[model samples]
Target chain A: MTFQLIVFYSFAAWLIFSALMVITSKNSVKAALFLVLTFASAAAIWLLLEAEFLALSLIVVYVGAVMVLLLFVVMMLDIDYAALRQGFVNKLPIAIVTSLAFFGLLYYFITHGEFGPQNYANPAPKGADYSNIKELGRILYTDYFIAFETAAVILLVAIIAAIALTFRGRKHRKAQVISKQLEANKKNRLKIVSMEASIEETENSGEQEPSTAEEKS
Target chain B: MTSSVNFSIISAEIFLLVALCVIMIVDLFQRDKERKLTFLLTQLSLVSLFVMGAQDLGLERQVGYSEHWIKDQFSTVLKLAIYLGTFVALLYARPFIRERNLMRGEYYLLTLFSVLGMMIMVSANSLLVVYLGLELLSLSLYALVALQRDSNIASESAVKYFVMGGLASGFLLYGISLVYGMTGTIIISEIASYLSANQANLMIQFGLVFIVVGIAFKFGAAPFHMWLPDIYHGSPSSITAYISSVPKIAAFGMAFRILESSFGEADIHWTPMIMICAMLSIVLGNIVALVQTNLKRMLSYSAIAHIGYFLLGLSIGNDEAYSASMFYIIVYALMTIAGFGIIIFMSSENKDYQQISDLRGMGRFHPWYALMFTLIMVSMAGIPPFIGFWPKLEIFRLLIADGQVLAAVVAIAFSVIGLVYYLKVVKEMFFVDCEDSPKVSNSRSLKIALSINCMLLLVFGLMPDSIYQYCISAFASLN
Candidate 1:
């Protein structure tokens, strides 16, 4: 009946509905749109859970970046929704059974579980001046320094990997072979010749060559 | 800032990182002339790292960086193996990469980065550190697999490896989060304490399943090994050699840290799942490998079977078995490097030597190369008086000693099934004849390195006690 409870229920409903729509929607684009909706609702739920930093990251990382990528891929591929859905009906029964069983298990655990108030109590609400990002950064840089550095290394590796995998050199472009340059020497690259000239033969040959060039011209 | 960071504990890693950056910059400026320099620098860095790691071989355990990492006798032993394995792999790969014009700076740089990742993983004492190190290694490997951009198969394999690797990472991260949730800590020592106190937690059991799945995928055990063959076959043999050696040692390090240290208390629960996976992997890896004509793919399957054998040690769930597993993985890494080294040495620019048929008349034409390959294959087949026999024998010895008779029997049976393919390689080398004889590697260094590598296998086979005692002492230090 309270406002927070109402907000939670509505967001929870929208999250579930959008998630189901993401899978069941016949159109791929629509499914992507529904996935966006699902992510947004999940972020809102995370907000309700007082994980403000996580909520914002979900929106920024998942919705802003990843969803756009998914949309681009879906639009570009021109995938046939009909073909994709061909076996859906045949696989539906087992899917339904598995999901229903999962749901039952979840429900049982949630309602009748050993995890209670003692193990997990509601965290105290933060003050208006508290900054989740600041607190997170403080712990991350200090206590978890190695983990932070490892993450940086992982991201660097990822960037290098992406470049290595996709970037092929263009052909027919003038490229330098440094080894060749390093190996080059005057003896190999150029020749200087000195010879005693046979003046009469040189003159006759030069004259014949010019006359042939003139005839061709 | 809880404790002052011990810079010396990670000195080798620091040295490698600095060398990596320096090489990258040098390569960038030198442009066309940087290939050989980069290769030399990478080798230099690895040698220095080996020296650095060797210096601390008998040092007392040092836990630093907020206990997220540790350097002990165990880690030092494994780090030396990684460095040595990688050095040999790169040495053998030089001729192959040079012939194929795949000698780019990125090839060597990415490998160094992955080596750094492996070092980190080997020393990790926290789940968070383990995950990050794994990601670093996986990302680098994905790139290395696709270094041959002109080949569509390489690109396809890269994509497949990336996606599957991402999925395995997700599984691993989820499991870590679950374990964190249950234990309220991420440190391995703390997690072990918590697990001992709360052994009945179903959530911990769930987390263990996911962790095992991730480990299985990394080890390329059955049911999670779909990407292994395709990646191995599609990758250039040079990259294949590097990957097949260093990564297995790193994975063993990770298994030791995560499973043996963090979740040791819940062995009864995890042992059964691991046993089933081991059995399936052995049966599947051997039987399927029997039909593979592509040498690389056959080796990948054999690698999987070896993984199953490695897991046999873990299945026994004791300290001796753990050490046996460590010894097994180290020996396996060496065997794979030598096997792939021959393949690289035989391959030329135009002829890839990808098929068993390509190896025809190798023995007749080049008896020395054939002799080396024969030693490698015989060792892999687990015949007596070879390095491979000792590890298998060690596994069986530990299993039978632990009263795991059925598991030992099944393992021995599968190993026999596995020997057929290794023998196939030998037979192809010795018996079969082809009209065209391929050119062998002209690099003297590669030939010499390979001879030493294979010779070590025999020498180690004869003197297994020294290394076996080293493994035992390292494990003993763990307690």
Candidate 2:
């Protein structure tokens, strides 16, 4: 029990530290990395709570995929850190005050209210063969189907919204009509010139050679 | 209160989902730039939804899908109202969107999707469902606001809306989390039962505070309303017309469901915060509206004021007040749609008439439209003989009946104070003189739609009880 307690306290502390770093890091890439650490520690905490499914999904989805993409984007972008921090000092007081108030309230409740191990006992441990995914799926599909479907629709809206807002069709694009291209029989596209074999035309052949090469490439 | 699985309770929702998918695909194959086919299909679906909801109004109130979705008269009435409001809004917005070159297939699709979102919200029986529905609605509106990509103002407003909406969602999720922790449940009816059995805890109180703040933010009650006027003014007038009217009703539904259905037994802790938001919205909305020159912006403030009245009714914490608030929101939605429809009518393809002064000589130039506009403005001002007056009177009467006479009188005085701005628009349309009139939209369909909308104010005003009873009956059956 003491060993488990030590492990939990360490992971919990690490989670809080990394979460703070995620917000306070100066470099974007560093912040993104800190976020990954934050998620990892959170997953550890969830595992300690016996929510193995949530812990695994959190690692697989957020840290493995989302954080990697975030890191790539953060590393690639040319962000102006100074400009981003221009109003940080001015806003710090209120931000600090608001967060402090929230923390104080949360802390008070954790200590004085209907929280802690005295009022709320730990959840019972499951059997070794328990399937977290199966249990989750049973309740999620049967009980929360409406919420699940609504969430699916929200994702659909996001897709529609992204495409609708960004997809401006090219109005003036010049392109070959495939039908017209397919209909070409060399009857109209190609014409034989009988009087073009002059000295000047032959001298201009060098420039045309590169143009034809460009088209071939 | 978990029940056997019954998908049939959500027959209307299922139909809407299938119809929207069909609409989305049908929109892709449509060749017309105006998307006439998609528009017709969308309206037809809404009408059918209205019918379905009306039929459901007589059915037994049941919490289906394991208490995750509800089918009750309250949700039914709200859904029917949403359907009717969207139908009118889309019709009125057609010319406006067409003229602005925003007749994309996605426009209709997103609006319908948002309607689905609202339908879900009005009937949501769980916090999870509420959050999902709210996100769907918010996401669609953000995209719709930013539909005009070329307009910098629209993009700005969309970002503002997205950020504020994200914050509001964050607050709500936090509150829901805390509530779940305290009560060990997320279902609405179950939460009420749990809350009634449990003692008041600081965590739950904090959670309820966060939830109330989130609701007030969604409702655009002041202190959380800094984002409203800008978003309304920045969105294309048609988008503005649609967003301003319909979502308020759905937000009311979601709030009522959560606060009353889930936290009704614990209203004592939340009502004070609601009353504060109500008072702040009233004072701030009215005084600020009086100074606004932009008519769209002014109407946005007026919307804020109307929100105050409804929130006041809500804070009263009684069935009668709830019904009155419901009636007020329905009336408010109808009037605002017509009011913005006038803005749509006055502006031509090349120009937008948004300034209050732009209505100069409208009465002289277009007598018929001007008359309808007058009725709309008069009704909005709560003048007797118009529909808006009855709802406000009902709210005020209920407030007095509940022994909050001072607040009722104060609310009435401010609404009367709100009269100055509504009448200002009226005076601009009539009293001001001009040599020539600006070219207005000549869409006969819009004209017909606006005429119908304005006539409703008079029709319902002369006999407010016709609609009031439906609202009364809706709350009569609420648990």
Model 1 agreement with the true structure over B1-479: per-residue lDDT tens digits: 76648888888888888898899888877656328788888999999988888788888988888889899999999989899998888888888877675778888889999999999999998999988888889889988888888778878888898899998888888988888977889999999888777764888889889999999888888889898998888888888888877899999899889988998888887888888888888999999999999888898899989999999888888889888988888899999999888888878776777787788888888888888889998999899899899989989998999898988998899889888898998898888877667678788898899999999999999998867777787888887
TM-score of chain B of 1: 0.97
Docking tier of model 2: it is: acceptable
- Cα displacement (angstroms), candidate 2, residue A108, comes to 6.5
Identify the runs in model 2 with alpha carbons over 4 angstroms from their true place: A1-45, A78-112, A170-172, A175-217, B1-3
The i-RMS of every model, in angstroms, reads 1.7, 2.4
Distance from true position, residue A44, model 1, in Å? 5.7
* lDDT per residue (tens digit) for residues B1-479 in model 2: 24657878788888999999999999889868679999999999998888878878756788778888888888888888899999999998899988787998898899999998998999899999998999999999999999999899999999999999999999999999999988989998889888889765777888999999999999999989999999999999999999999999999999998898889888899988999999999999999999999999999999999999989999999999999999999999999999888888887986789999988888899888889999999999999899999989888898898888888888888998999998988898889888788568899999888998999899999999988898998988874
TM-score of every model versus the real structure: 0.85, 0.87
lDDT value, residue B211 of candidate 2 = 97
The DockQ figures for the candidates are: 0.46, 0.45
User: What C-alpha lDDT does candidate 1 achieve relative to the native structure?
Assistant: 0.87
RMSD of candidates 1 onward, in order:
8.0, 9.2
